[model samples]
Target: MLPKGFFHRRVVLTAGLVLGLTGSAFGAAAGNTATNKAPSSTSPVGSTNVTVADPTVPRPPGTPCTVQLFSGVAFNDFNPRPYAYAPPAGCGTRWSKVVLEADFSVTAGRQFDRTATLWLGGVNLYFGTTEEPSSTVAPSWHVERDLTDYSALLRQAGNGQALIGNVVNSTYTGVIYGSARLLFYPASILAPAAHAPDAVVPLGSDPVGNTVSLATPSSQLSKSLSLPTNVERAYLDVFVQSQNADEFWYTCVPDQYAAEVQECGGGNFREAEISIDGQPAGVAPVYPWIYSGGIDPYLWRPTTGVQTLNFMPYRVDLTPFAGVLSNGAAHQVAVNVAGANNYFSATASLLLYLDPHAKTVTGQIERNTLVGQPPTPTIGDTLTTDSSGNITGAITTQLSRHFIIAGYANTSHGRVDSTVDQTVGFGDIQTFTINATTYRQVTDQQTSSDGVSQSTVGGFVTGKYSEHMRYPLHLDVNQVTAADGSFTLATVAHQGDEKNLAHQLFGITLYSAKLSNTVDSDDTLAFDASGNLTSHSNQQSTQTFAFNDSLGGCYRTDVGSFSGAVSSYATGTGCPGQQNRLFWFTHPDGSPENGNAVLGW
Candidate 1:
């Protein structure tokens, strides 16, 4: 099990160490650092809060050349900070490995968590939310991502922007600052350059990179592109961030009970839909990510929710449509959220792998059974109201879908046929009891996806990929008021994320892995009769992360905290033999593993 504050403290110390060792060299290399202005005299104190995630990105055995993207950029308003980017100098354009690293800090004071995004050439590189600050606690953290697949876009010079929409006033007084850089490892005899997408196409309303806002199901974010004709494989990475009334969608109710239950409408099912020239291509499940300030802020003081600091985009296999896309005509690729309520922010990018030996490839979509729209959810409710205006009842919602897409392309090697079979499911159940002096709500929700992609040449399988993912969440809230108007609020939450993946090339197992992370927390807040804040207690939280792959890479850690400080920390508890285990036996060619797949469709 993971402790609430252990991960946060560990990340803080690690970030400080990195800064201490390379601050001077990085500053000297960055000739023109972006900056709004120097911070005020009352600089924010570095925070100890951190997100629960893998602290390291497996690397090759070689030195890396660093390139500074931006440094110490301040964000206090709605404007975006623009920066210029160029390829690294010493490292050649083709690198064996590329990584993106960033550091962020917020001033100590009262402030709500804000959203942050980085975009280059109209493609989103990063999307996440900042940590909330308190009068005594200021938070700082570091994040890293493997950008080796996006090499095609990073090979050229471009202009990008970093947007951290924030509000700083007499009430909300916290300001956010950020610095980011890229590391490129040169290819050598031991570490050869890996295969990467030949072209990357951004899908959004603007060409210079920006997130599109979708207020309803009818709204769409689409892009038209004339892609290369030799495309052999294709995939799209998609992101959908819930905002406003949609933030707590899991606890929502049917439209008929919106007023009675006091919850959001449109049911509790949401998904991202992909389309190729108005034809259904694939589906991506929406993960429920809670921000630092969500619900009761005290619950996340030291530890944050899963992917709260840095989000992982869902990859949708579009290889079946590669034949249709390679026709050399301008095709419209679009993304939209199903069952959207109020609004949502969305972004996506198209990745294509070209047939190096073939100048032009031709084929057509043989079969596509996926419907353009998702099925309507089924909702059930049973409630009874008494004479005293007290209400008690339960509500449930469920939705599921299954589809298969198949196509063939005549490439330089041979006539390659590809098929994608997938299934998605979602369910939410909520129980409520409300009265004049008491209010209670409990929610249990789950979202899952299972899929298999296979490629064949002349009826013989060439590659096969399989992935299974599940997200489970539970939340309970109880509030009681005394006759004198004094009140107490108690909350408990349990969240988990699990994924298993495997890749096989010509019947040879190249990669396989399993990952699981979970967090459990509970707290209580007391208020005076006059409604002024009084005290909080019983604040406790714990987290655990376990990961293992066929490549001999294994990591496991558990930690717990109480009253906002770490209580215990342990490692290797979930590994073989119960011995602390953390190591990486990566392939010399930089093959994908764990979070990434070698045969990504």
Candidate 2:
């Protein structure tokens, strides 16, 4: 009922763990370094407050090399676009990081934002929202991650692959240009005792074949794995997709607790737990992807906000259970992914790190923090419509959503507990009658996740984050001929803002960033009796800003706006600024930020 990139942009139903970080050496070693802090009063309510934690292992030793896997091009309106990237053969085992950079060719200071996944081994590893080392956004920006934690999956003989753009149906029609690359470190350096995955086993996709069709939600999935012996630790890597993708609303930033899931039946949720052979093992947050909509894989690319096939990946440390599976026998391992009602479906694999000479895993299940499973936290919601059945005209309206989830991870050192939360989002469209033949509509949306707690471990790690996706829009229809055909949308204007914020305390280098975006545009449209777009007219201006460098924030070079074919419009010089602003709050002494003056399209 609305234009592409409008309502569809917010219907991202994918679930994920929102882990935002970047820095040359601000991280601890690969081994879970023993970890945390509590929340301050200024902290967002219901925020994740980790008391402590252990850092994961370090990157494997290898001759560092980078290879371009895929490149992006400009997209036209409502076109079906699908893209993939296959890394150079034989280099999969040497994996270190996956880097993605993107921007709009003609749009001014477009906040180059999108979500993608890296397919490695038999699992789909999520790249979530890619932010630079410091958290920033602009035309042509990039984000990267060290893949050592998942080296068991990406460092396989098959190398790695990736999927870009909306696969369900490429309705995200923007002239987006982007690239994906993988940085490889040699495989020769992995320590036989403590480094690299010794074995990997897939238990299969959820619903058996990724086709979810069951009257009742089934939460338990188990598979038997034949062992090679001497296994020391393990990781339960899993990927999940809710039939109701709107659950993506759970990860709204700036504050998920302050946001709203505007639709009545929308899915706004958090956290999915995984158990190994009926024993509690790992837990990860269910996050959101705002720019993902218009994707309906089940309906064969149906044009609607209802999403059927969208997935996010997360992992749980199963090392604590390593002792039980190292007896050189076939053991039954299972991960029961739970959510609201029976609305949970997922696939999991046990990546085993082994010691070829050691007797067996000695780690014991010393303690379990959470007991007796509970329901997920929800964002309060309210939806309203006017007499015309549209979210506009004669009837004024207001909507909001803010909710939270809280828990803790306990270790021998100190007690660790945390609270996680989110603000789904708030937006509305308005209409007024100038006459029976004239009407005007305006839209205003504001999304902020000032408080969102993904996870926290005592003395180990936990943090808070925020993201803002807000915009205001206006449209006027001065003429019409038939049933929603041959209509003239006189003018369309919008003001947009996007930003990401992450605060972390992981024992090593404490990291944080304030990344933000700014965008403004004006456009016009006309349709013929045949419902063909007869007008190629538009005028837009844009600008993106950043107060931190770690988030990949920068400014775009004005390409000047134009009025003609969408392709003929101007482009920019990508996000400009020190792309390498050192972390640890290390910007040039009192560095001056590029002002809003450099913004117009």
Candidate 3:
């Protein structure tokens, strides 16, 4: 089954496919390490300080009924993938000069968040990296020399390093079209070490795709270029791996803007090149490399085993597979990959389900396994998990049919019994329209297990308070009593007083059983300036927020805590309902996020 966040991505990418390109192309003329700085400019290209929602549409939501399980893909720092553009022939000729203003944003828990701005004339002019944390630095564009003359050779710098004519309007807006060459910097240029400081050592390989290695190992003192037959792109940029061992280092091109490069004297040295060895492995003719104001700390090429050039392609594979299915609602998808270690065949399946309107799940799943990772054992050294004998349950709101809650239970007595994983306890905030009042019902459950056998049952209830519900409501009363059995309760009213917290003075006795006479919990909620719910008051909490994305139905949540940082991951972009998922299309677009969601029994 396709994991949960795929469909929405397809939509966003599909939109990005316009004219086979994104914004404009940029270049780094030369940078100095002694006084590392971007080309001096007048006003900011576009305000790096502005906070605007992305213009791209949101993805689709995941189907609530689909069986959702954890997939192995991890979400870390976000970066823009390579893209190219071939603007209409007349678009560039229509305007003497052009400026590009683009905005990009992703949720905190997404895989990558990257954006770049570039200026171009006859050729790709230089700009800078944008949309990143401020501490990091990278190459940027400035008005060192005015736009003098436009020529063909300079515009088509032949081997990837093209020189634009001259600056015209310094600034312009609305889509500018041209034949842009989105160059993919050598893996070395996009390497993590290139951005590392003198004292530090790089931990791993480059995040970006290309690589540049010296044909023959040379010394930092050698200004003469030591040709590496392995240079992949015409411009295979490199950086000093370590400064702690030596004084300083340099490259063939100027390093005025490569802040990571160290200066020996007033100038940085470059190792000259002779004859190249390896052919361009995979270089895209016109690929897009995004840049935000500050350097993207996490942005880098995908590491490969060989130190070879892998440039962007003139035309990437953007076709979709025939096996992919799309429905209007959320669907859980699973992609089954069948192949040996090296090659594989894949097929995807879709499972659709709706979110429950309301209901709390409370029960100790004894001798069973809860869908994903087993719960941590607080006092014990080992917590075993059972992977066989499936158990599933659902939670639905009494009023609305739009939402639902589902759970997978694994029993200890399976065909191949391993260990038992039992649900300790769980609760839910049930939202439904009762009569005219909007009420939130609280329910909870708990369970214990000993690998071989286990059992548990828990429930809770709360009092009905107000008729009209605000956008961000405060924490209402909710608890589970388990002396002999378990049941939940919430504050319907104050013991005998009609006026308690809100000040409607009508005092009754403290004997009303339905009205919370004893305060079991004192929790609350916090909202943002936009009335959007931000945090909760409860000491222990697990809240989920659902939203839409380009892929279709998508969601994010804070599993626990107020002070602890919230982490979110997504699943289901293709085949829904299946346990395993594979990429049906390296580039999938248009399908709703729900269509790619997956559900497993």
Candidate 4:
């Protein structure tokens, strides 16, 4: 979400490897040097802690391209939201990286043929001993023959090179692909090879389909490939199996390049379900909690005094504190509480390590029903992850800002139409910077006896302003209203020089729409006692809400004015009171509106 100007590609590396190559004419005639040397049986290549390529075939920087990563909640606000690492626009979002040992057994049937090939700037390296004075000369780099000892290699010849350096200059730049890979430390803790479950391959043949099982073992090939590494970042192109997507699982490494990995603080929680008239009308994830026997994905804690909340179907206070193991790996200990059959508490610990050689995060979680009760603890699963970089690939923590507007119905509606979804998000902690852009692409879909229907829309209008801008969009459908949609975008313009302010223009209501052409131009401002911008609007039923306390811990005021009409009619005309108009307000934590004040016509 960085401003377009913030994103520029310059020559990342000019002195290191580039100068090493241009220094002498020796590389010019070294075109026929070996890429790597073969290892002896006593020194097996796969047997050493230090892995290196044979001198004849240098290492290949597998993929030569730059990717902008982002994580945290994109749309679905299921607690910590889902984490995603998207590449820049237009580029294919699905990127893949595979590291497998190149034993003859696995590569026998593979299409590519070569024991050792160096990939640099999108080009492959083919090395052979031939005394020819050619410009395609390989560098004399040493690679591990078997981990214990290093083997020497010479330059090689290659003409088809892909530009990998700086995209802006049209000049391939950055650290040499071979050097980066050769320097990367070993994989964090050596994890056992993982396996996927068997499944029948699916077929779309007109008549019938068959299932086939695919096998992929967790293996790292003894080769190094570099992409962009100057930024403190680590990312993995994970291929999630269909079945595995049911929950959050990790398959990547930690970033040795990260500057630091620390535990930020947390907060309190408040939950409520909307009640039109004291009856359970509807519910969302607002202050929601889940009490599955250690199966629920609650907010995680890895630091002390640092707080987080559990808002799903169960509510729990989270405290975070740093542990003694604060090396590249940091740990957080937490306690979960409630008070009897429903009351439970426990202390849990989690690791936040970033060293490439120490990749996975391992910790434990424990809980009990009593104050003095011994804790029943379970091991928190390990995650191989990368610390966020300067530009920050994505906010690994909660970063979406949302509210809950919900109501109970005679029949539960699946998430389809302008239906109110309980949304949860974070505000401006160093976590929610310009790098955090909220893209709301909503798809309301349904299938029933009447028929099947689907409608889709996106709030691209939200991305058209400054970094501090906040936009809110809503969609709702029930018995009274056929469907409805609204968009609210807001940004602050600081007082500046008159000339710039005049030229720039201030307080402009770009667009607003309702049922027809009526211009709902009435403006409204909502504020807490301090008059902070809780919510404001030039009415199209637009609104912005602020919790008295941030992190949605306290909802004390309506920060913005809202003006909208609800068309839903009561299920029956037998109501004793005024026309049954249902109004719902949602919180970022998924709580819905319960109070109702009649508005006279």
TM-score of 2: 0.44
Q: Is candidate 1 or candidate 3 better by TM-score?
A: 1
| lDDT score of residue 197 within candidate 2 | 61
**Residue range 1-601, candidate 2, lDDT tens digits:** 2322222112221110011211111110000001111222232122111101111112334455665555564432323233333444655453433222222121222112233344445454433321111122212232333344445544433534443332112321224344555655544434221244656666654211221221122455566677755654466666544333323322221133122222223233334556555554555443322221211111110000101112224444454455556655677766543333334445666666666655543333444443343433323222334454433332222334454434332223223343434444333333333333333433333333333343344344443333333333232323333455444444433323333433444422233334333323344444454434454344433333334435453322111133311111111234344232222212211111111011100
- Quick one: best lDDT, which candidate? 1
Which ten contiguous residues of candidate 3 have the minimum total lDDT? 301-310
Indicate the worst ten consecutive residues by lDDT in candidate 1: 26-35
Off by over 4 Å in 4: 1-264, 267-335, 338-392, 397-535, 538-601
Q: How many residue pairs of model 3 clash at the backbone?
A: 131
lDDT of 4 by residue, 29-135 (tens): 11111112233223322211111111111122333233211112111111111112222333231222111111111110101101122222221112111111112
Q: In angstroms, how far off is 88's CA in candidate 1?
A: 0.5
Residue-pair clashes per candidate: 11, 71, 131, 65
Select the stronger candidate by lDDT from 2 and 3.
2
- Is 1 or 2 the stronger prediction by lDDT? 1
lDDT of 3 by residue, 296-367 (tens): 111111100000011111111100110111112221211111101111111111111211221221111122
Best by TM-score: 1
**lDDT value for model 2:** 0.34
